[model samples]
Target: MRTILQRVQHASVTVEGEISGKINHGILALVGFEPEDTNEDFEWITKKIIQLRIFNDENHVMNLDIQQTEGEILVVSQFTLHAATKKGNRPSYIKASKPDLANEQYEKFLQILENNFKAVQKGIFGADMKVELLNDGPVTIFIDSKNKE
Candidate 1:
């Protein structure tokens, strides 16, 4: 599992001209899955995301987690995060999980977030989505469950 976490002042996702999910003063998480991903991967990533201290505290230090700030989260499925491009000009998605497995994991991931946090928003899996965000501090973090070390 891989996630690109972007701390944002606000974020929104639109599908077919309709807003699907949105959040304010939170993180926009672009989540991806690999063929070998499991529930353990989901559990680890979810905990890391919510507990990550990217938001600033009163002293202007990045010391507060999302829960401490009472912020929300916007998650979007993005298989391209697993793209393999070492060989040719075109990127290959062979490392990415198939849609069935990816979708299942994606839903489970969202559920885990919802269970832990008060405000968790998500974009539709396998849908064409347009994501908009005002990146707070332009702070972005990349995490991969498989590469814990």
Candidate 2:
């Protein structure tokens, strides 16, 4: 499992010119699942995301976790996170899980996130989505559950 986490003031996802999900004062997570991912990876990544201290406190220090601030979350399936371009100009997504497996993991990931956060929004698993976000601090972090060391 891999994720690109972006701290955002607001974010929303649109599919076919229709708004699917939106959030305010939270993180937008583009999650990718690989063939080797398991439930253990899901649990680890979910915990880390919710507890990550990216939000600022009164003293202007980044010391508050999403759960502490009651922040929302917008999650989107992003197999492209695993795209490999080492061989040629075109990227290969061979490391990305098959759609059937990816969809299952994606749904599980959504369930985990929703269970942790006050509000959680999501994009369709395999739909073409347009995401708009006010990236607070433009803060972004990449996490790989497989390389947790």
- Which candidate leads the pack in lDDT? 1
* Residue 128 local lDDT, model 1: 95
The CA lDDT at 6 in model 1 is 99
Q: What is the alpha-carbon lDDT for the whole of candidate 1? A: 0.94
Q: Tell me the tens digit of each residue's lDDT in model 1 across 1-149.
A: 99999999999999999999999999999999998888889889989999999999999999999999999999999999999999989999999999999999999888888888879988989999999999999899999998985
Per-candidate clashes come to 0, 0
Q: Candidate 1: which stretches are off by over 4 Å?
A: none
Please provide, for model 2 over 1-149, each residue's C-alpha lDDT reduced to its tens digit, 9 standing for 90 to 100: 99999999999999999999999999999999998998888889999899999999999899999988889899999999999999989999999999999999998877776676658889998999999999999899999998885
> How accurate locally, in lDDT, is each candidate?
0.94, 0.92
Alpha-carbon TM-score of each model against the true structure: 0.98, 0.97
